[model samples]
Target: MTTSPAPAAPAGPDLTDEQWTTLVRARATDPQAVAKAYAARTRPAPLLSQKDTLFLVAADHPARGALRSGPDPMAMADRRSLLARMVTALDNPEVDGVLGTPDVIEELLLLGALEGKVVIGSMNRGGLDGATWTMDDRFTGYDAASIATNGLEGGKMLLRIDDRDAATAGTIEACADAVTELATHGLMAMVEPLPYHREDDGSLTLLKDTPSLARAVTIASGLGTTSAYTWLKMPSCDDPETVFGATTLPCVVLGGVPSPDPAQDLDSWGRALVQATVRGLVVGRALLYPPDGDVASAVEAAAVVLRAAHAGEDAA
Candidate 1:
């Protein structure tokens, strides 16, 4: 069952080599440029579009030490290449916004690539990937106050629950507090919750079963003083309807580690989008460092899936 391919991406912005150098120089010599750019940016009127679906390009993985994409171990390690790919993806009109850490977000702001786009700040990244204390995901990135002051629409946090790991408790408590703070500011508190277990070697393994995913949703939904402004950033598990049914809050499906077969990954997202609660997509390496190296094509394809899902909702 081959799905139709998405339309080829149009030519993106022609950023010159000199411009890239200038951006780097500004970052070093004029650190205030980022703040000035943010002040000058044309903020989006509302976070969501008329369809109430948001397609956000995520660039927060590198901060967590998870930089591998496809077969390359350090695919996302190059800041220039990563930012270039991100720029290309954002140039597409179908791509609505971005979710990134402070550095990445500031870079985009300086480049003027985030103007009129929904910006989501990544809140937690202390749990370095593949570390022994990976479950101790701390809020070392953006906090609610910073996000509000920076004029971002929301903030995202990672919540990985491991019964055997005592760090999970700290992560949960931190996320709950973050939710409350973001809500107090009337900002979105996006939480990505996943259940896991520690292996004998001290490595963590994600439990993708519906039951486990459902439990994570249940626990995450109840966090904070209110679920009023809370949103769930969930993975596309086997039974998305059953798993996502565990929450009534709005949800967006994340593009997990890039898959070898991009089509299969798109299919998984398409299946999950059938659920009304699955608002849209928040993808990263899959679109930024695609197997074919066509960042624009990858982003457009995901946007197509999101549009189709919304169309179905309208028909219903």
Candidate 2:
């Protein structure tokens, strides 16, 4: 991969000799280390890249405290190991960009992993994984101005509303404003909408019916000041046809909690991306942190699914 131009050093007082050495060490592989030092010196890094779009895996699992997988799952809580896997994945030609929080993005920026590549920053992390607030999603990552300044290509926020819980209103209002702001800055804002409900046992869940998904999509599409820059991040539900009727906006299926049958999950997503308004897939745990340890194969398989959809669009 060709290296994109490094961001100009943040303008400020000169770096001390020790700091300069630290930066040199940071440039080796740790993008976050470099970003932190640059921040300490008040010098933000430059844009990594702005080209291509395929499957950009989301790797923000740590914040949710879901370190383990099914029975044998791990905390996956180690930043360094996470970085290593991400860096390796980013180098793959089939993969385009990454969807993650500021820490991971900055690390990629520092390691030069994002040079001449798409960089999409995750916006809402406040929901935390599996927390009571999981459905109330909030914006805690790069904002509109940050996306523009950081040279990021786009921004994404989750909008999982559980109106029964009374927090859905806030999530809706926040998403509306976020959509407008992102559009005003000419940034692509991907809104992942889910009509969710918490069981009596308190498990956050997605509604499986067509009307529920349809109503949820309608509510989401109508958010913000305009739908021009907005795109839908939907689930691969049983009724893509019914769900597809909910909006004309471009959509992409999401990889929700990994299912016991991953092949079935990918097949479902592949079908939706092909038949409906889906433009692509925004897969997370299912593709990046899979049950098996083979990330490269999983990503390649996803790309095939995406390619088939794109080819179908071309044919039509």
Candidate 3:
């Protein structure tokens, strides 16, 4: 049995032909270059930007097999397009950093798109999307040891709690340990804890109501030995105040499922941004695969919202 030569290096609008060739050659020959790049890349300072807020472009969705965006189920299936869009978003200086798994981060590092940008590695990708035990969300990606050794600024974990799923217990325990471990390294532990309801059909639905979100917030806030280095990555809810009131931990609003109407999505983020505890925005598909397919515009629009929120607070 013979394997066909690997398909031609993927191409994208912003992925120059030279860069594509470089990636191809690097993967085929210089695998160690990734570590070399990590060691040489310039790290960010103060973590958050001048406004004291994080503005990260999330690229960890693909790790869990969630490649849907808008009407396209496999919108993020193309590595070239995904990395190109991420590079476009990060090119805008206002965008502070990125949250991704090791593969995505390494690719971006090789692409030279992360210099001077804070990098947060995603943990807990074992619970693949659509798997029966997806709620487990086990730690299968970056561990604290690797994160520290790789010079990453932090680690992010997903904690989806379902009352009927026994796996949730183990997941919670794992996240707690991760939180403690990340903090022990003096690194940020960004925990995204969401309430999930399991239906009789075995499907899980996120509970976004005020009470549900508040409960989830409280649970995540109490994880690990200390909350000093813990931050929350949450979705914007109808009642931002009530939901955010549950904890004092600094929170960053995540752009969940994208809507065709970008205005509606930005509006929701604006509301959450004004909340005292909400500090930033970590978005992915909403900006990467916008309806218009303009990644830069989507990223700029989000940066504007972030700036406006902090400006409003200063004016107040």
Structure candidate 2, residue pairs in collision: 7-46, 10-43, 31-110, 32-107, 48-116, 49-117, 64-129, 67-74, 67-75, 69-73
lDDT of 1 by residue, 1-316 (tens): 9976443322333457987898989989998898788778888887888788889999999999998877677777878788888899999987789999999999888888998999999999999988867788999999999999989999999999999987789899999999999999999999999999888877778899999999999999999999999999999988988998888889999999878889999999999987978889999988887777878888999989899878977776
List the candidates ranked by lDDT, beginning with the highest.
3, 1, 2
Off by over 4 Å in 2: 1-53
**Which TM-score value belongs to model 1?**
0.94
Per-model tally of clashing residue pairs: 0, 10, 0
Which residue pairs in candidate 3 have backbone atoms (N, alpha carbon, C) closer than 3 angstroms, thus clashing?
none
Candidate 3: worst-modelled 10 consecutive residues by lDDT? 4-13
Q: Per-model C-alpha lDDT, please?
A: 0.88, 0.70, 0.91
Comparing 1 and 3 on TM-score, the stronger one:
3
Task: Return the TM-score for candidate 2, rounded to 2 decimals.
Answer: 0.80
lDDT of 1: 0.88
Summed over model 3, clashes come to 0
For candidate 3, the TM-score is: 0.95
